[model samples]
Target: MPERKPRADALRNRESVLAAADALFARCDSPESVTMADIAAAAGVGKATLFRGFGDRTGLIHALFEMRLAPIRLAAEEGPPPLGPATPPHRRIPALLDAVLCFKIDNRHLALALEGTGGGSPYAAEHYERWHSTLQEALEHLPGPADSAFTAHALLAATRADLVEHLLGQQRMTRDQLRSDLKAYTARVLGSPASVD
Candidate 1:
């Protein structure tokens, strides 16, 4: 059977909920503090509407995160240099990590909310698996004894939302400092000279 398109009202409600949630997450001190009720109220929808549109808080977070991450994913899969597959793996790997770091930093609250959604192993996340494999593939292409799988995990660890928040909030490290440190750290791992640019 052909699936029915979502009613216009349904689509509008979805957009409203997502926009409200995004704004709340962007400004909130803590992701956990933003509740479904808060989102519903912010969107001017009922609690039932929020629940009906999204299964739960986690579902809403996942949808919002996916929307935010789509561009980076597209760039990695098919876009131009630095992030695209056409870029050499050595450069692509660094670029991927840099993008990931910036994404988590820019969307810190949303990222943290997604990360803290459940007690399940974070490795189980679909996004985690996709990025892990992307990093692992690039790492494998480089000539080295680096355990690509472990290296991928370690590289990703540097961009964790919690770590980014800690360093930026309490450690007082500027974004440039973090980027430079990450670039230098990646260079040491890959046995390449760090580029000043």
Candidate 2:
């Protein structure tokens, strides 16, 4: 059997569909609000083609979230070197928080879409759990007592979706402020000698 290449026009249509979905998903209250018709109209494609490109609306949202989160995953995995005894806790801890804050700010819409409403799917839970574990691993390497795990959990809660949303929407704090405060609080919880005050 030979690999079949997609037709040039099909490729273009797929790109158009993805672009439309990205734009609509950002503004829609829920992923369900982004109908196939809306996407087809936005992309200048027929409804049938939209379905052909992305099976269903959930599939489209999944692809959109995956596309937006790829860079974040890479940054979390490789952006800052893992915390270690040789690494200063103040420096490495702040870097980790900054990385997550940046990711949340950059992908706010996609993250909201995935985990905001509709009771949230299993995918969102899995994503959050993975992040929690990654953060715990970083905290484990910090020069702290055996109870660093609890401290890590507390820090993660402070940097969670609800906190970020409140900081941005209600408190009107700049993204930099949230990132700074999170890092500062995390340092305090970890007992880092460098104080932000």
Candidate 3:
């Protein structure tokens, strides 16, 4: 007998589940508050279906985050200046960090949920490796004595979703203020004091 692919209805259910989860995460104060049962209810699917589709809450959050990040990934890989490979490392680094900060700001709840304890260490994620590798390679081209690898890690760390949430929520830092601070801080790290514009 031939292997059977999942039914069309199953595929539809999976997408619906992910969409429902996204909505729930967006509205909730914390990712922990959005339970699988809540998502299953929202999607009109059974708990079993939700688990079968995503394995667990963490898996579901990871999938949703990947979907949201797809466009940004594409832009970074091939879009115009500041983000694309065609841009110089000095400029590209700040652009990349700024993009990351903006993304986190725009998707605070989802970003928070995805980076939450259930989602595990961001450092362990594949996307983190890609971002780190890109930044590390860029740092290598700079004239500083900074360890490219370590510097990349430190740079990315500055944009961690939890830290962003703390700054925005608890610290009450406005978006522009946060962006300027990050740009200035990134410039200092790169030994380019004049690039803080």
Candidate 4:
């Protein structure tokens, strides 16, 4: 049988749950501190409703993270300049890296939670694969021979959530400084000082 589409109320409840979860993550010092019960209460839904909507805590976190990432993902997939298909390789690569870094920084708690979901290596995640392929394809367009696959992985490693948190939260590196540093480092890898942006 075909899966039934969610009713209007179910859709509203799902949105409420996600919004509540997002707010809790933003306010909490630790992601584990925010319980499913708390999210249900905040959303004015029952625990069963939460589970029905997202299956489990990890599922909920993944859904919320994806919801937040939708805009940037759309931009990278189809939007204009530096993030879209129309942009030049040299400009697009750094723009892509910068977007990943900014996303991690802005969504630190949620990203951290997603990373700790016991789902194993983050390298296995669908989002990671998509970002990696995009970066790799762009790297292939550079002037000389280079291992685009490995280069993409290396660039993404620099923007991992834990590293971003350590630099921003523990080490107290400002956002602009980190971005500039990443831009510079990426330039070195691409073998073009002019590409730093």
Per lDDT, the best of the predicted structures is 1
lDDT of candidate 2 at residue 183, scale 0 to 100: 70
Question: What TM-score does structure 2 among the candidates reach?
Answer: 0.71
Whole-model lDDT, candidate 4? Answer: 0.90
Deviating ranges (above 4 Å) for candidate 3: 1-6, 117-120, 194-197
Q: What is the TM-score (0 to 1) of candidate 3?
A: 0.91
By the TM-score metric, which is better: model 2 or model 4?
4
Rank list by TM-score = 1, 4, 3, 2
Give the lowest summed-lDDT range of ten residues in model 4: 188-197
Report residue 86 deviation for candidate 1 (angstroms): 1.1
C-alpha RMSD for every candidate: 1.1, 4.1, 2.2, 1.6
Winning model by TM-score: 1
How many residue pairs clash per model?
A: 0, 0, 0, 0
lDDT of 3 at 124: 76
Candidate that beats the other on lDDT, 2 or 4, i.e. the better one: 4
lDDT of 3 by residue, 16-63 (tens): 998998889888888678999999999999999988888988788888
Candidate 1 TM-score, C-alpha based: 0.96
Backbone clashes in candidate 2 total 0
Backbone clashes in model 4: 0
TM-score, cand. 4 vs. native: 0.94
Q: What is the lDDT of candidate 3?
A: 0.87
For 1-197, candidate 1 gives per-residue lDDT tens digits of 99999999999999999999999999999998999999999999999998898898999999999999999999999999989998998789889999999999899999988878645556666788899999999998999636999999988889888899999999999999999999988888888988875
List the candidate numbers ranked by lDDT, top first: 1, 4, 3, 2
Tell me which of candidates 1 and 2 scores higher on lDDT: 1
Candidate 1 residue spans exceeding 4 A from truth:
118-120
